[model samples]
Target: MSTSTAPDAKTVRQVRPALRAGRFSTVLRVPALVTIAVMVALLLVLFALDIAIGDFRIPIGRVLDVLGGGGTRAQRFVILDSRLPRALTAVVVGAALGLAGAITQSILHNPLASPDLLGITAGASVGAVAVIVGAGGGAATGTLALVGVPLAALAAGLATALAIYLMAWGKNTAGGSGVMAFRLVLVGIGVNAALMAVVSWLITRASLPDASMAQHWLTGSLNKADWSTLIPAAVGLGVTLLVAAASARTLAALRFGADTTRMLGVKIQTQQGILLATAVMASALATAAVGPLAFVGLAAPQIARRLLRTPGEPVIASALVGAIAVLGADLVSRTMFPIDLPVGVVTAAVGGPFLIYLLVRTNRKATL
Candidate 1:
């Protein structure tokens, strides 16, 4: 047999970079994978704890037994009828918000680009509050009121997102990266402020009982979590997450700037539009499920990115982190307070300090 010919310098150069890139990817993947595994374990623990620790404390063994369909009627009612739905709703809402936030931040290339700050949540609040006020202090019972709130919130949230996108779009700044991002955030803030004012006005005009109900919901309580709400929320979250998985490559490319993304054969505007739409759907669904959760969306992705040490937002990790955050916050609200506070209160308290930290850190880096 004849001896094989040696590779040329050109082939060697091409292969070297490919090999190096493969190794680099492997190095990144291992840590991220490990982090995800840990988060998954933590989520399971929190879920179980949430179910087990309540006014009537069910042991972990009893919780597991109830889950497996072997517990008594009382246990079944407690775990299956009451606690399970709330815990599951928390997980679904958290994951949806987290995923939405990750997608938003990645698309906008800004750490602060969350549905909460961008007026999407506020829009949902407007819709829900309007419905609550219209229902005469949430007295409107039956299927219409039950279904109407979520539908209204979803519609309003999507509308607000569309408005923000249209308002932020500028022919002159379309070519520039930083200008569009800054403009979008600024417009979002203005819109959010306007929406909050509208919510306040609606609440004020509402009767006392109605205003109380509206205010409670606005605080993002899980008191209304039942099978009816949880099922739809979970299904919507699952479908949207699948869409997000498909858009992963596009998101990664987007982080490389619009020019580079276009160079890589992505239809920049179209892809970004689709991703934004997906984010809006996810956020709206979550908001529909559990009113407006302030910082779960804003904080989850950044925490995940930092933990994973990934250059771009890690979608799955962000989801896990978000679910854990909300569930943990709910647990704290229920257990730590003299009276059970809304989950939103704890998140805002913690997230406020976290936001300030992020701002200070970013400023320091900019100065350097």
Candidate 2:
């Protein structure tokens, strides 16, 4: 004869924590899933709208037809050859920057942390500008110019990231403690200022034509987007994002402070190194594709966090928000302005005010 028994106090205690963790995960996941679905829908709409509204202004229906491989010659040429590449480039670059920003912000536990603010983009700009100046205006042509600029940008950006990391490193903060977030940001800002000065000086020294070309690129235009650049960038970013997604649990743990993260069995320094490198690669690729885009990185993750009501940045949602933001900015630049303005200009106008709001909000929270 067997007797039924209730769980003991210790068993209950362990089971209760597990149950609560499961419930909390479910609660967090549902909201994030819903947010992602909505953003995907919004991105699709913006993408269709972008393809439909150009010099020729094809109807949305026709745009769909073209996409489905059933449209007239002119429609096909305009959509496939002219408009699609630029729109896709916007999506790719925006997503890359957004993911990079989200990772940087979350791992560092700083809302203001972004590739732009941390000097990654500035370093890329310096490299790209150097290429333009070295090659002269028209001399930098064909495969070398096309490939050389991005490679230089990636190299320079990685070097800059390395510099910031070393400068931010301290004896006390070394070992398992990792670099402090605040110190990293301060060093990054100083590096960013210095790099921008170098870029300005380089431009000033160049000839009129070279300077104009560099200046135009520095403004971050999609006019340079081609299948050659876009394909490689998209593939690289996709792989990096996969790595980031796999590290999602580590990122979540990191937010709870170093002791808690260590308790959770995450090697803090190793994870930070991997995440920071992933972020730098993403940012460098995007900057290489389109010159350093301004606040897509800074704004998208914050916007996603608010929209999802998540305590930390939602990587996928932030990426979609970034794609929408850039695509929308590109649309507005193309349609709203008498002259087609650089997409960067439109983003800066919007992001400048958003930055101010963030500063004000952070100040208010501190005061309280």
Name the runs in model 1 displaced over 4 angstroms: 1-28, 172-179
Quote model 2's TM-score. 0.90
What's the CA error at residue 245 for candidate 1, in Å?
0.9
The residue pairs that clash in candidate 1, if any, are: 137-210
lDDT (Cα, tens digit) per residue for candidate 1, span 199-237: 999999999888988888889889878877776578768
For model 1 the TM-score comes to 0.91
Query: Candidates' TM-scores?
Result: 0.91, 0.90
Candidate 2 C-alpha lDDT tens digits along 37-64: 9889989999999999978899999999
Off by over 4 Å in 2: 1-28, 137-139, 171-177
